[model samples]
Target: MMAAQVPGFYMKNESRRVKIPFIDSNSLVIIPVSVNGSEPINFLFDTGVKSNIFFSKTIADELGMQYTRKLNLVGADGQTVLSASVSPNNHFDLGEIEGIYQAALVLDEDFLELEKVIGIPIYGVVGHEFFKSNPVKIDYDNAEVTIYRSSALKWKPFGFRSMPMELIGNKPYVNTTIRQIEGPEIPAKLLIDTGANHGLLLNRETTDEIVLPPLTLETDLGRSLGGDLFGLVGRVRRVEMQGLKFRGVITSYPDQTEFSDVIIETGRQGSIGAELLNRIKIIFDYPRERVLLKKGAKFSEQFDYDMSGLMIRVLSAENKRFYVSQVRENSPASLQGVQLYDEIVAINKVPAYFWELADITNLFRSEEGRVITLEILRGTGTEEEAPEKLRISFVLKKQL
Candidate 1:
């Protein structure tokens, strides 16, 4: 059922919408947007957030936005909370879509700086408030997002399964089943968070019925408003959705203590993020209380992760070098003597300066058992003085 009217945004034709190009960086959707005629900025097109948020205080202050007061925000991660100021009257444009946000939060810290970890610029985030007015389509295959007025949506497409969703605090939650190897199917409620990068994230408590895979590895999932999210990564034997069974799906379970009280109150098992949603065409129909899904080309592709046991980050774009942000103990990279803060000058003889962070990360995920030769520079003293360069070879092996 369509609401009487969606506030905030209006369409010129009401029947046609335009597709905006987006960068799918490290599984996060970064869309270009502008606020109050400011230069275009990248905002995370996150379905998990409730309100529009500008993460940079500098940006907020420069805009001359008035703040009502400060409030503490608890995140879905359950562990992190942010103290932010509530500002009103924010007008933003996303291609042909434009809207006025009566109130938006601005964090004191440049949460957008987190984008640097992935080598991108994400100034803010647009969430439920932006989508509430119209139907939105995310075509991951073509890396484009399309906005449709309620009238333009067909509502139902062939070969798609529709499931009712419960809107909790402006985020969508769905009840689904995850099959265990020996026990009955585990019924769980999960959030549809395009902002999250993982395929499946279950609170540690939800895995009692479903046994954990034989192989699991300690990994740093990502950052949350609270802190860095660290967890054990593994695979679920099967996840059945709409009569379709996805086997050997990669999954993560964060510590129970990390989640906030509100998340626990909602009894949310975990979240289904872009990693899984990208395998299927998904429609988030909040007003109708339903979500639709159709299989995508990558539906059958194997779930993969970085096999090098090394988490790398771009240290300097001008220098074209990457620094080891983290090294998993006992992993291939660890076994090969890769250490934290080690600069990567080249990979397999190709200068690291010539490769983008995404491509370099992909190279590390190449076929398991493949040999990767990394040229490393140790130490962080004066850069003018040449540092020691060492060649270390490691075989790409699955950690979990």
Candidate 2:
């Protein structure tokens, strides 16, 4: 579907650029946005999607927004379709900038469950609508997004590499090369997906040259609106674009059966997500059909995977309580008796509440052979019976 013809304007006519701060949670960008004069709400700023999507129908209803039509929304897995109502002619206020007569899709059900997964209240996602009319620069180190007016801004190439991008179906795709552990360099067309948290994703069905590495770990890649996406995690020898290279990059290979049915853009092989993008400062110049990139502060940091093998979720609205949502079999966490639904009370004697979800995730990805201690409360606590509290310690190990 085409993106809505929503034009965004600055609050002040003389303003040429506006900086909007964002929260980098799990490598995903979250920004505060107010819709139709409502209070500021947390929204995911995603380049992977074309439309603004509201997961809560109640929020739209409370704002007294009118639905103009019904739309069928497809999940990332391609098979699951959900019903949605399109609310047209809505106003959006993104701090210093505002868009009038914007279109938004309100889903009938809260299928993503992003709040539990990200440990933050993410109401929806805003994508092409906000990016189509401007040159948006993402400063990863500063945690801010600078939106420049296409008409007023002058392009400069100072220390930045410019790469041509293809605008297809309201999404941006770029060409690059990937070197697998055992093969020659393979040409690839990857989507610039800021919404995805992983470093890279390769669809093995895309080409014969794109093969899984010799070593791979079977794991749950992530959740799509359809359901849990199972995949393999491995490392590529190198991935290079425009003379910039990243070595030993972690890559995800979603099962072909899970994504094959989905109609992808022509010649699209995979996607470059935020985990890798976070290592560089990026400018999405959609108006000119190009992307500008420069090295970021953490450019030289090595890519790491989760060594704990525990998928955690926030069980409280405040994002303080943590629980083990999934435990990979035969991994360190599972081997150490970390089971699903185990409420993590403390880590290394430090209260789990004192740690943010990002901090915990980073700790698990810190390094292999690192020792971790956890005190967890398992089972339900009844009036007469109390839940069992146990301490489990494990050494992190690299599975792949």
The candidate scoring highest on lDDT is: 2
Clashes of 1: 4
Total colliding residue pairs, candidate 2: 0
lDDT tens readout by residue for model 2, 1-400: 1223436534445467788899989778999888889999999989988888889998889988899899886676767888999987788888777877878889989888888888889999987877887889899899999988676445655888989999887899999999899777899999999988889999888778888899898888887565677889999999998889999999999887645644343679899999899999999998888999899998999998889989888898495999998898899999989999999999999998798888899899888888999999988999888999999999999776
- lDDT for model 1 comes to 0.77
Q: Least accurate stretch of 10 residues (summed lDDT) in model 1?
A: 1-10
TM-score of predicted structure 2: 0.95
TM-score of 1: 0.91
Q: Which digits, one per residue and each the tens of the lDDT, describe model 1 over residues 1-400?
A: 2332334655544557767788987667788877777778888989898878888888878877789999987654664567899997777777677765547789987643555466666778888886775667777887887777666656576877887788998998988888754456788889889988788887756446646666778888877665677778888877766666677778987765645455667778788888788887777777788887778888898888889999888776556668899999988999989999999888999988778787887788779989999999897557687677899999998776
Residue range with the least summed lDDT across 10 consecutive positions in model 2: 1-10
Give the Å error, residue 49, model 1.
Answer: 1.0
| lDDT measured at residue 112 in model 1 versus the true structure, 0 to 100 | 36
TM-scores of all candidate predictions against the true structure: 0.91, 0.95
Q: Against the unseen true structure, what C-alpha lDDT does each candidate score? A: 0.77, 0.85
